[model samples]
Target: MRKIFTLLTIATALLMAQCNQPEQKVDVSPISDATVKKVTAELVKQHGDSQKERIERGVAQVAMLWRITDGTETDFEQFCTTQFVSDDAALEQLFNKLSYGFEMLNGYFILLSKELMKPLHLDWGPVTPIDELFGSYNAAAHLNDDLYANKIAFITALNFPYYTLKEKTEMGENWSRKQWAYARMGDMFTSRVPAQLIQNFSTVNTNADTYISEYNIYMGNLVDDKGQTMFPADMKLISHWGLRDELKSHYANKEDGLAHQQMIYQVMKRIIDQSIPQQVINSNEYKWNPYTNTLTKEGNEVQATPEPNTRYQHVINQFKALKAIDEYTLKMPNYIQRKFEGEFELPVDEVEQLFIDLVSSKEVREAGKLISQRLGRPLQPFDIWYDGFKARSGIPAEKLDGITTKRFRDAKAFEAELPNILTSLGWSKEKAKFIADRVKVEASRGAGHAWGAEMHNDVALLRTRVPASGMNYKGFNIAMHEFGHNVEQTITLHDVDYYIMHGVPNTAFTEALAFVFQKRDLDVLGMKEVNPDKEYLETLDNLWSCYEIMGVSLVDINLWKWLYNNPNATADEVRNATLTIARDIWNKYYADVFGSTDEPILAIYSHMIDNPLYLSAYPIGHLIDFQLEKQFRGRSFAAEVERIYSQGRLIPQLWLKKGVGEPLSVTPILEASAVAVQKLSEKK
Candidate 1:
């Protein structure tokens, strides 16, 4: 019921004893099988052959879910007999009413949820545990109970019996918009998870989010083996994002750039291993020597405790919470199946194969060779984040920061500049104004995010880390990414014909657009790429990016697989397992080129803690972005984007085919990347 435009996260556990638990599937129908069959036949006999198919399906569907408290067998029979609409006009009318009703219900709950999360998400004052408690409180947690109690869920389910993802994909090819909407309506009540369990999931996830959001590292306090401080005294970077971006920015530093990158890599390793001192996390109180693993105060060595595996502990908490949901999801029995087929509209194996294919291809080796030649050195583990291809990479960080801070002194300034940013990307003035009017800008608490509106009139949120001083270059680039999400959100919601088909298939689709916009950040600043082979360079950049994150995603996937297998694993066990998994993936795909066989640098992605299994979306989004960019050749960028997104929520394959005339495969970029590598190498 709650519409969360968040970083994608959801999942849980096992096969042998999966359905054996006594309490599992306790919500079985109290109505007898004989009664259900008899009622179905009677409803069919009354409705005649033309209406017989729907009558039987609807009656049986309702009877199968009827409980003792809901009604007796006789009441179930009577309700089905009276409620079944045989006429086409009548059915359409009923469908319209139900659709409108649900939109109102789901939309307003989303609005409420946004307000509740504002304090935690926004830069509010020091949040108390009570604020976190309220933030976790999902108002729609019990909305399912209310719907079932009032028989709304039963009625909807009866009319539109649930279709599996396979069924939807196959049969949906011929179905009209109304039919697809009805199928989704059927999806509303496939299984009844208890309200308390939903609340539990919400609470667990919220706490994990709070943890990751506050996980900051004081970069200024870090020292090398020789007791040298290399960073600005006031520099503070949050886990993964700030640290990674800082590493990227140093590419222009030339002077001691490698040293800075190595230091950041060491810092990431400490974070991944949970050996970073507890006192140093999110604090500037202590000086740290990451290479030596020491903490000190005022030049005096001090005893500092490690983080005690809180990083992995939160993951286990999420795992256990998600595992508790296994029995409740009957169709897609396990978390993996549900996450891929149900939500992503793709299979896990399929997505994994796509990732694996690209990572293992000849294109990757060629790209790596090109990168190493450009760097004039052997590749390091941290080279996975090579950022030299972009147009702005040559520009000084201070120069970019000066421009960004001067232009966007505050959130309000950025808000006012949205229309211009939009127009810079080929959007007409009227269209730009329309989108900007519905986009709200705000200071974010974490590495920012975009929160889309639920209802038509509500404004979409663009949250970014605008410091008290001003927005920096990193913050500006991220803001552009979030702005892409806001644009997609506004378009899909306000322009789509059906509320049920309002968004793109999943978060990955939005991520694709965000990547697209992010690629154009410099263009928005009137800093066009001067390099002749910019497109080819951009292609290589995306390939390297995909190669890096795909390995990280493999680690995340395999880590969860390990957690499920070792259900009773302790925090320390998972921590050790995580490092092993990360190293294993790195060794398999990245070791030969990087000259490092067991580097756990990939495990440093913060998404693993707060947004499980979501790292895949980024790489997959990059793939889609490349393919879409290919199709967008010679087309008006703004016009085509509106056209593509306006196609609305369809299954991934179908959406890709309609949007780009090809199914989602990495071949486009892989093939193009090979050509790019050859071209750039020939020039050199």
Candidate 2:
């Protein structure tokens, strides 16, 4: 699946700035409680008693954001008295003006950032240091500062007063589309993080992203204990995504599948423990035996340096940068809170509990046993990525690669066929053309991502690595997934009712749609599932996928918690803690299923290194995808997706409930998987 760069990505970038800086005393509000009371009372008197709640909330919100530099108490009072729009028509007009202005500002800023990062993101050339610097330069870093300086931010905050997640959940059910738009407007300018801090965080984050992007393993150079190469001579796979996908593909290769999986498992362990030789990463100069951690050049053993714990150092740098912004964020004082409550609009405890419940379920063990029986062997640690349930697992990887490479000779070929891809999935030709026209495909420098456009006129960029030889099956599958994101991005932005409400509930929701589109990749290629028990097998696939990712997500969550507790710890300490956490989580949830303990394979996800706290979305997306698949069972797939996502940017549970008529839960998948396991077991 692809990383989604939406409005929240920009928000997070700006919010998580400022590295190693002491907390500045920015909490002292210039607008006093007395002034707030006086302003509220005066506004109520002027606008009438019926507007009391709006007056009070608006005044309080303005006061929360008002600094000494903003103005004096008297000036604050005058501004509120003069600017508070109590008339319904006038307030609506004000909202429209702000919404239009903000869309232009935000959309252009997003465009600028995307353009600046193109050299780093696209398959252009070798990324120079200058390219990295430009990628890290946030054009809108001072957007908040500028808005506040000109009082536009204060005006928006006052009129559309920020609401808590509790408030939204409790009241959003009764809200009109316009009310939801107003609430979204209130979401802007909630923090006053400085531009320098934002730039610093961007630099740190860009560096980490570059590290992960380039950390490819030359698989062809990997040697077994007997000095045998098991892969194609030209094959190189990036960490986690490329490696994991390569491992998953071997499920179709019965000849040497087990040995291949074991070698990849060892490679992952070395990476997690920082024992991977430095010369082997992104270079094929030496033939390295992953099993023995030895590098050999031209039949001679060569001394090699370990990676020096650079992975954990990046983690620590990100932590410190995010921690520096905690003081500026008054309501959600930490990065964790900001990420969950402020961004996801779901609490940390709730998400964690959801993951724990699913991982601990009995369905997982039954599914694992079923997989073991199919494989004719006891489960290995890498079997967490068990791909046997999918129909593709029965098809040879080479065949699929040949089909994809021939069909999509380049990025442009795929781009041109997108409309056909959409129409094959049940969209009308006109509708398909409408969506495909707004999405541009690009060959990626790293594992691809979907970069959504903030403005309606702009196009969403679907980036995936298409080798010079052509687009392979893995790249094609990923392109399909990214196409899902682009379709959603285009729909939510152009078809939604309000500018502020121009996205799904969160990244998880987008991931769900991506999964939906991904499952239909073979269908798009005119291949149908011939298996009589297709639905049951698919259910099992969803279950096993969630089982694997949920454990990884737990590691990401707990690792962040450990970082908070040990802020002063060294990279080596962080590395030790991460391995221990990965092992503990593995023992708790995966050991019984896979019959393996202390497996740090769960920590091998590139997302944990480059995109912090993002792993949870994949599993949650699986749950949502199951529900959406159920919804589309009898209905038109394209129509159902359009209907669901058009109701944009609601809270997750509310969005799920409205779209599929149930809240986000694992029960649907678990119950279905149980039946699937029983039926499949009977078939065998």
Candidate 3:
């Protein structure tokens, strides 16, 4: 907590620095309505100056205000919007000034983190300065960008808690600064895992090229909430391709990238810090602790905490427990699972082969053919799912939607059924009653997905923002998905230690937990009963979904690289690059099924423009969900479900390891799909 506070102090200092310097000669008196007119006139004269000059003058003008803080915001707003200075560029510059200040504050908060652990007794090496670690440079050295570059520079210029204002304002770098650099570096490199990948890191794991494609498809879909394509035919050239060769030099190595990643996570973490449980702090006992850490609170003897590097290992252990279920999913396959109409079973080996065949099936091949002809590019296997998935589960997809709409449209209707849903899953009446009481569902017209926001208090909020258009099958599924998130949210946060951490490890980790429910959602709706045949279909769906997103993520990674490399690329060029990426992924992965010359479906994804570097989670979630499901299969559903969800938020990988007895891996995807395919084939 002390460390976190220190980090926050630095951020505070950055925000404070945004004001006029104390050394400047200026009045401190509050400005009145009359003064606004006078100052507005002077600012108008300065408006014609260069951007820097305008900023300097504004700073000096602000210096004169003695106790002027009261109405300064209003006065400034009035002045800016007055007839005297309405230049768009001028307003933009002002925005830049304000934004720079905001970014500094954002960065400062980001530097603070609860994840820090006690250093290992073993000394490693000399601490590095923050500037050197992150390649800090003076204003002269920083490159100019529309936004990010400026924000980064302003943040770096601020002082840390250990340093006084004078020392912080010093122009030159120092040894202390270097230490900050090293810690920041360490934080970045170690955020998730060293091996944990970025968007375009590799094809074997969650590939970037595939992700980008999927992003585009989702983004495209989001354009028209009414299930209409928002993209124009001619504007399809902005897609991301493998621009790694271009982006590699800029970022250099893992350290640089990790630093940025950590920065984003840290900043967002701070903004939402209030929402996080206090029990997560490095403390022995406190009320409001999450349930998972209660064991520690109940005991007086404190277990020795692991050293920093190894500390993550405990979290990893937890991650394994959560992820152990991935292995079980790998046994289910797609083809045989889909082929079975009702009760059926097949040898696991047969399921695996059938899964492979389904991935390369003729229908999947045809989907590629359709996409390639439409987009004028070769098809990829990843592109198959967004299309094939729709094609395969046509009626079921619609039916699921109908189920959600019927249940969700009337909040009370769903609430009444929730108790049954929970109890049927084996929850005791008391436990079921508790959940039923806390759950609150809301829906609104929106393009983004539903989310469960856990508040600081005992109460939890499960809100879904639906597109303004009427709810559809897709909307229903998304709603159900969010419902799963809310369920995990309630169990983990409400039941955990009030002071201890109570939440999923990361967005992906939570997604994994929510998916467990989503997979079972069909059962909840009685759409896909847990009969042998339905289980087989579910397995097939999982494999297809995972395989498709792997390709989509690939595209997403490449597109970012493209943007990084060709910063000046026209929309058309970006679109062309996207087309090329789609073709490349499709040809390589789907050529066997769809033919070597077919086009890819990446063009249809809606996420490309809306969310960046986010498509990979679907596959990862699938891989994790199946594994977690296996652990609870034979157990008393409610007891095991509560125990698992009760773990709340731990470092994702570490949490799984502890809970599931294994490391995070993709075996679950391979095994489950294979088994489902074999089973479905036998049914036919």
Candidate 4:
């Protein structure tokens, strides 16, 4: 669905004996305040007052990380005095060397990781235990510790130092590209989580990912009360992406659409509350009736067990793993802080408020009413996924599938056409070929994702579920989204001037570009929309999308908050809390619009279980997508994307301002959606 940011690989941990043990605090800095002050004074005297700020920040940073094993106070002082550089030319040379070394180190590590994860991620043979073991091994787990032991980390820290989010925001306006790269280099050694902990996190995260990747529901086996199968006999779908997309697809069917949607909605509820039969998940031996929550085998009802809160257990396991690392972090002591302030570079309160404003807006309610009118029936809770605003909703699923399957028969076929796809989006032939040659498409075992390269010499990967028969329309759409991520990844890494600034501000920005590409899927297929009211419909569609995902994101954010507040909670407790949070969010934001309350459908996103607190990025991405779309109006799409993305890794607001001429806010989408609703209502 979205590109997985691999930087937080250390945040995930295994549910083993080490995870069960009490957290051992790692706050063992031996350098005292006097030592830090003495080092700073000595460096400033040697370097001059012109380098005062750098010297002071550098010394303090090194002092904070120096441990008893690292050396005594004299060693720390000596290290800082000897390593600190005041000359501009020498410093630039040092920065270049460090950047080159880090790029090699990180790039190879990523390559190794991708290779190890192949059996688990790719649609190869069945994954064996050895495959899982290899996947869990973090090749670069000890790299940070190794750097510290060799005093390279100290050297980097002494020169570059660390900048708070506040400092970056306040000073970034006047900062040159080199200054920003220096700031990012400063970010490399902020914390020193143990290598063992890092390895453990990797193992647990891989396990969780494997769990999600294999969680497929045999949709064809699901029967109605009358024992009639609604889906094709071989129709298997992964939870929640596959199931959710299938539900969205049903909106095009006027006759059986409602029944199919209701069935999918029931399945979603069962998944959320953990009431679905254990036998029905990833198995087709039993004929399951989701509506009645019954399973019949050989025309006889058989006993079945509910999933034993396995979903919630994964969440608890992740919480414990991340919580174990809490005491080790310095500036951001907890996962929540690290996620929002450290990673997102945005505050949680601000994100929550953004979602609340959009979901509670008059425009959302008006759009909901319009969706209800278009359906010619009362809106169901599942209507959160209304797809009629897009042109595809009016096209038959079989026709679209036939077109895609013929064009993209397999992964190689899709790979061969990447250049064509890029050219259709307005890139020059040479530029399109350059990008396409650097992107490799492969068949995925799970819902697809884009993995960008860390080195310019490497290629970005686009993975989607390409069936043996052919690539379906859904697969093509997901491939397009991931191709967007690859394009951004390639541009930022290969086009940007600095090695350190080779990515977007956060995963949300990548998701934004993915959304942009996804919206143009039909156009890329040479089936461009000829509707006169296209822009208005798109606005409504964007608004409704934000409305759906914002609530789900709130559930994810609030659930993490709950886990943090109640650290001793069990799996069942977490499950109950999640349901309550989901229901509360649904009642507050979605109930009035859909004529329903206490619906747990918002919690059906798989990200909550595997990727913690990642759901918020989608709604934020939608907002960004809308802004970027506005910027692309009557402009060369490829040129704007390349130029904007090449501005890599600035703080979110500054990046948005530079790209779209306005800071990030919901105002643009809200105002546009309000006008769209009014105009569409007049026509009705």
Q: How accurate is candidate 2 locally (lDDT)?
A: 0.88
Q: Rate the local accuracy (lDDT) of all candidates.
A: 0.82, 0.88, 0.39, 0.88
Runs of candidate 2 exceeding 4 Å displacement: 7-15
lDDT score for candidate 4 against the true structure: 0.88
Q: Find the candidate with the highest TM-score and give its number.
A: 2
What is the model-wide C-alpha lDDT for candidate 1? Answer: 0.82
lDDT of 4 at 557: 91
TM-score of each: 0.95, 0.99, 0.45, 0.98
Ranked by lDDT, the better of candidates 2 and 3 is: 2
Candidate 4 lDDT tens digits, 532-607: 8899999999999999999999999999999989998988899999999999999998899988788999999999
lDDT of 2 by residue, 118-182 (tens): 99988787889999999988887777788888999889888887788999999999999999999
Off by over 4 Å in 4: 8-22
Per-residue C-alpha lDDT of model 3 across residues 1-684, encoded as one tens digit per residue: 000111122221211111111222322335555655555455556664533333333332332322343246565445333423235565435434543453344333322211111011001222234412221111211111212222332222211112222232242133332333322211111001111111111111112212222221111111121223232222111122111111211122233432322222221222111222333222224221111212133323234332232211222222222122222112221212211210011222332333344444543344344445533445432334333222223343335446566665644455567777777667788888887676755442122233332333333334333333334445444455666666676776577542124455434555766666655555666654435465555555566565565666566656555554554455445556766876786676655654545354544343443333345455556656766776776777677667766665443444566566554556665565566555554554
Q: List model 1 lDDT by residue over 1-684, tens digit each.
A: 012353211111111012112254457787787887887788778878877766666776676667787888888888887877777888778777887787676668777877888888887977789889998887776766677789887788777766777877788778787777677666666666666666766788888888988888888899988888999887778888889999999888777899999999998998999998899999998889998889889999999898999999889877877777677666666766667777787888998998899889889998898999988888999999999888888899999999999999989999999999999999999999999999999998877888887677788988888987799999999899999999999999888777767788877888889999999999988888888899899999999999998998899888888988998899999999999999888888888878879899989998899766777778878889998899888999999999899867777888888799998998889889989999999998
Model 1, position 513: C-alpha lDDT score: 92
Clashing pairs in 1: none
Residue 191 in model 4: lDDT: 71
How far out, in Å, is residue 511 in model 4?
Answer: 0.3
